[model samples]
Target: MDNFIGEIRLAGFGFPPKGWALCNGQLLPVNQNQALFSLLGTAYGGNGITTFGLPNLQTRVPLGMGQQGGVNYPWGQAGGEAAHALTTAEMPAHTHALTGSAGGATALGPANNLLATPAAGALYGTGTDVSLASSSVGPSGSGQPHQNMPPYLVINYIIALVGIYPSRS
Candidate 1:
C-alpha cells in the first residue's frame, strides 16, 4: 500500500492544540511532546548574527530585554554582577538636592543662599565625596556608581501552532 494515500486529519482546529500529534509519512501518530520541544534550540529566523531567537521549551518564559551584541543596546553592564529583578522596595528613591555655587570666602546670609555652605561645621545634602578619574567621563571609561549591574535576560522565542493531536489514553 502507498503511504501517501493514507488520510491525515487534523485533530483540532484554530489554535495549536496542546500535545498535538502529526503523523510521519507512514500515517502513524507522531510523538507530539517530542516534536514540539524539538522545534526549540533551532533558530526560528533572524539575521543569523547577534540577533536570533532562543530555544523556548518552558511554558512560562519572561519576554523582556533583548539587545543585539554588536548594536548600541542599553544593557546595564557586561560580565558584571547578577541582580535579580528589583522589587518595589529596591527601586531608586527620589530626592531633590539644593544646587548652587558661591565664589566668595564669606557665607551668604539669606534665603537665596539656602544651598550655600553657611559655616565650616554646617553641611546640608552632604555625604561622602565621590572620586572621579579624568577618564571616567565621556566614552573613555565607566560612568558613576562604577560597579557591575545585575545580569539581564532577553526573551525572543515564541511557539505558536494550530490543530491538535488525539490523546493516547
Candidate 2:
C-alpha cells in the first residue's frame, strides 16, 4: 500500500526584532511579521515559486544578498507595512524539506528529498558560511530569493490552508 502525505508546510511565521544580519558584506534580518509572511506565501505558493516575485521587490534596499541574486520583488502595501515580498532566501532555511507526495528516501536528514538543500549550484546566503538552513518558516533576501531551493508543497494542502481563512471569514 502506497500512502502520501498531502503537504508538509512550514507555516506560522513570527520572530523577534533580532534585526538583520550581515553576510558577504550585506545586512539582512531574520525576524519578520505576519503580513510579510502572508505575501511570501502568496508570491511563493500562489504565483508559483518558479515565477511572480513579491510586490515591493523594487524598494528592497538589498542589505546583503547581492552576491546571491538580489532582485527585489514588490507587493501592494497597506497601512505602514511596506508591500514587499519577503525574499524566500531570508527564511530560516529549509532544515528538513520534503521530497514529494510519496515521501522519498530517509537519509537521516530531511524526509522529503525534494526540498532539501542543494549539493552544488548557486550557493547563496550572506557569506562563505555555507550551512544547512531550516524550512520551518524563515525569511528571504532583499532583492531576490536566496537560492532556487525548489520549494516543495502539495497543492491540495495549500488550498486547504487558505480555505481555512475563507471559511472563517
Candidate 3:
C-alpha cells in the first residue's frame, strides 16, 4: 500500500521497514527530506532552516489533535507525566473520628491514649488536678511518585519517509 508522507503507524517489528523511519524525535535534513519537512515543519523540534524533527513517540502514546469535552489539545502538543505525587488539595474531603472513654475504669480503651483529664474530681477522679495525655496518628506515606499511566502494550511508531505527499482537500 502507498502510505502518505509523514504517516505514522505502530509496528510489532523491532525495526522500521524500508522508506520508514522510527519516530524517535531524530532531526533530519530539510534539503534531504523536503516532502516530509513540508508537512511536518519544525513542530516537533528543529531549526526549520537546515533541519526538521520527526515526531518523538518514545515511551509515549499519541493523542488526537483538537479539543474534547472542553479540553483543547493542539497539534504536536505533549502533556501528562509518567508519574505523579498527589497533593493535599487533590485528596477527598473527609475527617478521622476519634472515639473512647475517659476517667472511668474502662478508660484504657484504644482511644484512651488520646483522651485528656482536666481537674481530678471534675469528671470522676479524686480532688486533684490531673491532665491526661494527648495523642495523634502519624502521617502516612513516604512521599513517592505513583505511576499515572494506564495499562498499555509496547509498540514502535514509524513514520513514512518516502511516500506520496498528502495534500489538503
Candidate 4:
C-alpha cells in the first residue's frame, strides 16, 4: 500500500524500508527531501531554510494532537518525566498518635491518678497519660528515577520519506 508523506509506522527491523526514514530526529537537507520538508516544516526541529528534522520517537511515545477530555496537548509539544519524586505537599495530611506511661507506681507514688492530676508530691504515674505528637513522615526511597514507562515491546518508528502528499478533505 502507498503511504502518505510524513506518515509514521512501527517496524521490528533496525533499518527503514525503501521510501521510509527512521524517526530518530535526524536532520535532512531541504533540497534533497523537499516533499517531506514541505509537510513537516520545523515543527519537530530544524533551521527551516536548509534543513528539516524528522520526528524523534526515541524513548518517547506519540500522543494525539489537540485537546481531549479537557486536556490540551498541542502538536509538537513534548513534556513528561521518566520518574517523579513526590513532595510533602503532595502527600495526604495525617498525624501520628503516641501513648505511653510517664512513670511506674514506684516512682510516682501510685498509679491511681492520671498525669494531669498526679498525686500531691509525685511527678507522674502509670495512668491515663496519652502523649499526642504530630510530625511529617521521613522521606523514603533511594531517590532514584524509577522506570515511568509502561510495559512495552521494543520497536522502531519510521516515517515515509517519499509518498503521495495528503490533502485536507
Candidate 5:
C-alpha cells in the first residue's frame, strides 16, 4: 500500500542532502542540523517514505478559557465569583447636594427685608436670597430604595488566541 510521511524541507542557499528532495524535484543541500524546515515534499524520507496527498485539516478543536490557572489567553482569575447588586441599605450612606444660589446682597430686592433672620443651624442662606445652601436641601422620602435588589454578575476576560496547529508529524 502507498503511504506518505510529511517532510520538512528548507529553501534558499546550497543543495539539500542526498536523501532529501525538493517538492518540485529541485536538487539542493539542506543541513539538517541548522537548516530551516518547511512542510514540503522535498525532504527525503528515504526507504520508508511513501508518496501520497497531504491530509485534511481537523474540523474542530477545543480552547482553554484561561481559568485553568495555567498559561492561556485572557489569563486571569481561575474562575468567577458570585455577587449581587447592592441594596439601598448596602449603598454607601451619602447625600447629593444641589447647587447653591449665587451669593450677593444686591441680588435681594426690597422683599429681602420682610423675611426674618433664621437662628444658627435653623437655616442657611441670607433673607430674600435664601437658597438651597440649607443643610435640609437633599432628596426626600425613603430615598432608601426598595429592598428587592437585582442580581449582578461579573466575568473578567481580556485576551484571545486563534489559528494554531501542530507541526508536521
Candidate 6:
C-alpha cells in the first residue's frame, strides 16, 4: 500500500520479457545519448556531428584582412569552438552538482585571439568578450556535469566537452 514498497522489484535472471515494461528511474549518465554517438557525434550507422555539426558558411573569410573571429588567419581554431558557441542563457537550468575541478583554471589568450573564437564567427568562451554568446561560468552558471561552472571563467576541460557529447548509443 506504500509507494516506496510498491516501487521495489527484482526481475528473474534473464533479459526483459516482451510485453513487460520497465519502470523508468533517473537516467544513469547525464549524457546517456553519448553512448550512441562517437567522439564525432555519430553512431549506430549514422552520420556524425562532423557531418552535420557545422553550419555552411558562404562568406568564409578571404586569406587575410581583419579578425574574422577564429578564422582570422592564425591557428586553425579547432577544439574549443562548438561548446562555447551558445550562451548559458540558452542552456537548460542547472540541477546537479559538479564533478571536476577547474580549481584555478583561467582564460588564456586575448579576446582578439582566433583560437579563442567560436568557428561560427562568434566571439565567446569562458572569458570576457562582449560578444560572447555564453560568456560566464561558475557553480551558478547553468548546465554542468554536477554544478554550474565557476563564474567569470570557463574551465579548460568543460570547454572541451562542449562540442562532442561523444556517445555510443
Per-model TM-score versus the true fold? 0.20, 0.13, 0.77, 0.72, 0.16, 0.12
Error of 2 at 126 (Å): 36
Cα deviation at 146, candidate 4, in Å, is: 2.4
Query: How many clashing pairs per prediction, in order?
Result: 4, 38, 1, 0, 7, 20
Q: Answer with 1 or 5, whichever has the higher lDDT.
A: 1
Which 10-residue window in model 6 sums to the lowest lDDT? 153-162
- Please give, for residues 1-169, the per-residue lDDT of candidate 5 as tens digits: 2113233333343443443333332232233421222333332222213332221111211244454557555511122223344446756888775443333333234463433334233345466854676556644454443444246332221111111223545
Error of 6 at 25 (Å): 41
Between candidates 4 and 5, name the one with more favorable TM-score.
Answer: 4
Rank by TM-score, highest first.
3, 4, 1, 5, 2, 6
- Give the clashing pairs for model 1: 16-161, 20-165, 21-165, 83-150
For this target, which candidate reaches the highest lDDT against the unseen true structure? 3
lDDT of 1: 0.35
lDDT score at residue 118, model 4, on the 0-100 scale: 40
Candidate 5 yields a Cα-based lDDT of 0.33
Show where candidate 1 strays beyond 4 Å: 1-32, 42-69, 72-108, 113-158, 161-169
Pull out the clashing pairs in model 5. Answer: 15-28, 15-29, 16-28, 16-29, 16-30, 20-44, 21-42
Clashing pairs in 4: none
lDDT minimum window of 10 residues, candidate 3: 103-112
- Candidate 3 TM-score to native: 0.77
Q: Which stretches of candidate 3 lie over 4 Å from their true place?
A: 97-139
- The deviation in Å at residue 62 for candidate 3 is 0.5
Candidate closest to the true structure, highest TM-score: 3
Per-candidate RMSD, Å: 15.0, 26.5, 4.9, 6.9, 19.8, 26.4
lDDT of 1 by residue, 45-75 (tens): 3233223233322222233346666654332
Comparing 1 with 2 on TM-score, the higher-scoring candidate is: 1
Off by over 4 Å in 2: 1-99, 103-106, 115-136, 143-169
Candidate 1, which ten residues in sequence have the lowest lDDT sum?
A: 21-30
